[model samples]
Target: MLVYVVDHNGQPLMPTTRGAFVRIALKEGRAKVTRTKPFTIQLLYETTSFTQPLSGGTDPGRTNIGEAVLDAGGEVLYNAHITTRNEEIPDLMAERKAHRQASRRGERKVRQRRAIKNGTITFPLEKERTPRGCEKPIVNKYIRNSEARFVNRKRPANWLTPTTNQLVETHLNAVKDICRLLPVSDWILEINRFAFMRMEDGSILGADFQNGRLKGYPSVNAYIFALQGGCCACCGKPLIEHYHHIVPRHLGGSDGPENIAGLCNECHGKVHTGKLSLDKLGKAKKYAALSVLNQAIPFIYDGLVELFGQEHVHICFGWQTSEQRKRLGLGKTHDADAVCIASLGNGSQPRQIPEPYEIKQFRRHNRAIINNQRERTYKLGKETVAKNRKPRFEQRGHSLESFLKSLSPVWRLDACQVMEVSKSTRYYNSEGRCMPGTVFYRCRRKTPGFIHGDIRRQGPSYGIMPFVCLHIILMQASRRGVMPT
Candidate 1:
């Protein structure tokens, strides 16, 4: 039999006529017999070779070794009897399968355990039974411990009678004293008494102590009690000393505690008179005030001035007011409350107006109003910007092709240059049939239809074996301004 080996370029790779029955050993350790019978050799030559052999024979009479295979005139024979060995193939596959199965089993066990822990599976407990010689379970039996007696059954009626209550209270107070003396006593006598009393009455006392009760105000009593517990109304701090009105009473606002908050002195002062505006209060307080104002500006403005001092207040009667209205050359006949001016002390020089009392009063009343307007405008602008921002390209499902198209011309040109280099190498080696200079060796242990294989080359530059011909072609075309579709 005669055999021939070829490289990726379809060129005759070995020395012609050097040997017969040529054996090609692939890098994956698989060897194939290309020539076997005399008849097969005749068929190969007649169908694939461009020349004819001098005589009919199974042997090519030469050793053929090279980088590519060529159409040599010869009586070539092929066979299917070649065998390759790879001992680790089956073991590796078996190990992979075992690992996969174990992982699946572990996942299933974890899911089952989670289900059971989450009460998705409920198992009935087995009924308890004593041995034949043991006594039956007893009802209404009492077990005595060091501190108390535990009853096996429900307690009797009349557990909270006046006489019993008095006796229990007396004993409980004494026990409390004793616990205080011992310090390390296991019994919590007061807790036990409270629990016993609650259980006996089937209800709790003092739980709704402030229910429906007014504390000199028309607001919800619960908030007043909360205020009394030291929570600040303006900042929700826990150490409040001053009570702030959401709407000042001077503007016909109610004295209801709901509209008032218990605030610390700092928060109270910042509430209306400081740079902080009513609008800058936390969301909870802001929403609460909005509910009271019913979106009315007159009420909101009045509330702002009352909480913030008039001197710093900037708005009144729907306009800004300041002490320097005359210095700006405004008419004296204008209504003092209707005129608009900048707030006095926000780095603005204080003007010496004729009436000091009126100036001081205006400063005290307008501070909060101006700050509130500024804060509201700032918030609106921020929200508008957030709503109008554009979506990012990555978030828009851009494909690789689209992304490449969007790159700058210079980057595209560079990519084309790279592609051209690859394409040149691919076609240069293959004689228009298969890419040359590279060898693909299939694993003997692999399944017949599997394409998994190692890439190799016969030349010294084995470093670049089995090049991706398609990538090279496309890259070349791209460089030439003819990119692949």
Candidate 2:
């Protein structure tokens, strides 16, 4: 691994691979560690600011982003793959909205009770009327206690969805980090702009481009019925009464024809009950990635041009990237594609291929504090009881014998107990050896005290690990490209 360096004034200099030099500099108090993940250092004395021209490349994707930096000699200086949390955002948002709605409903119930006691409710209650067979009940306006504000809520011209915003931010943050770590002069970004109609069918031309799959059809249900040969996709029956969503609506799936399929009532019920799978019926075409990329790419390009000048920022298409990658005989990975993007039109083949840093992004902190956290319950003396249930067992495991000497402490206690533990993952070096770091452990101590005993094969280790701690430490680096030391 190479150690990135910066001057005494905190300006990024070329990174060095010599371990001995860095070690001696640190030993003599001439340098200090700045970042732990990438192992960067900063000089404590004055140094020359002269540097060679370098170029960088970025390959943006829906969930993952690849970045690389190359020196003037075509030597690969740094490369990393970032796995974003785009896939989990929709579910998280749904959970948050659910919690908020529940809290509001509880507050409204309290208000209703108070109003009844105060004789403030003079109006008669009325039942809401909803459409026949609709699952959602139409709520009365008075009982709703809130006016419809969706019409008043206006979105800005540059507004983006939570999913797309997270993706765009991930790409921008990765680029900003690399630019601050190296002296990159120019950047090449590979972004794919897909033709949705052409991708679905290659024969679309002229007037057909304007006419979509549902052009002649009266409705989406009719189109799907015709597409599936007017038969149930699951049982191949002629009775097609229901339109099933191949991808469920809860997970941000759209109502597009590609995601909807014709199904009978029996098959639809079976699908909802998990007896049938979507793949068994027919493979559903997903355009989620395409849609996100189309909206996020323009914002990403504009952001890059604003940060690094318009002249330095360049855009490359997927076809050109594919041609170059094929010519270079590189594998089809985000990192390999990034290398090809960097060396595009420059004929700069990498001297040696190195394992790129695998970085996974996580939310800094959870926002919902009162959400439905799983309650730990265990059989205590033939009766199930919650761990947090209270008149309270606060004694240590060692001292538990004084309370009941006939049975062992483990036998007297339940199998599961609530305890605060750090979330951790194993980190490995390029040599395929695991690096020393904190691991996950369950504490048996009912009260706050030193934990002793085996932690599920992790061995007897003691420490007060915090809940949801940040294991990966980030370094504070300059956000601007190259600055004078």
* RMSD (CA, Å), each prediction: 44.2, 13.2
* TM-scores vs. true structure, each candidate: 0.15, 0.68
Best by TM-score: 2
Candidate 1 — which residues are off by over 4 angstroms?
1-81, 85-93, 122-485
lDDT (Cα, 0-100) at 344 in candidate 2: 73
lDDT of 1 by residue, 1-485 (tens): 13344333232332234343332233223333333322111112212323321111010000110000111232112111111112223333455556666655545555656756676532332233443343563221121112112333456753443322332333333323222211110110001012323443555567533433464455454566464676765566677676566665444344555466666878777777765555432122222222222223233233334533344233322223324444455443222211112222122332222221111000112222222211011012223211101233444433334444666987866643443111111112223232322333322334443232222233343232333465554444446554222
Backbone atom clashes (below 3 Å) for every candidate: 53, 0
> Candidate 1 at 356: error in angstroms?
99
Which ten residues in a row are the worst by lDDT in model 2? 473-482
lDDT of 2 at 364: 49
In model 2, which regions exceed 4 Å deviation? Answer: 127-138, 141-144, 216-247, 251-254, 258-285, 345-347, 369-485
Prediction 2 TM-score vs. true: 0.68
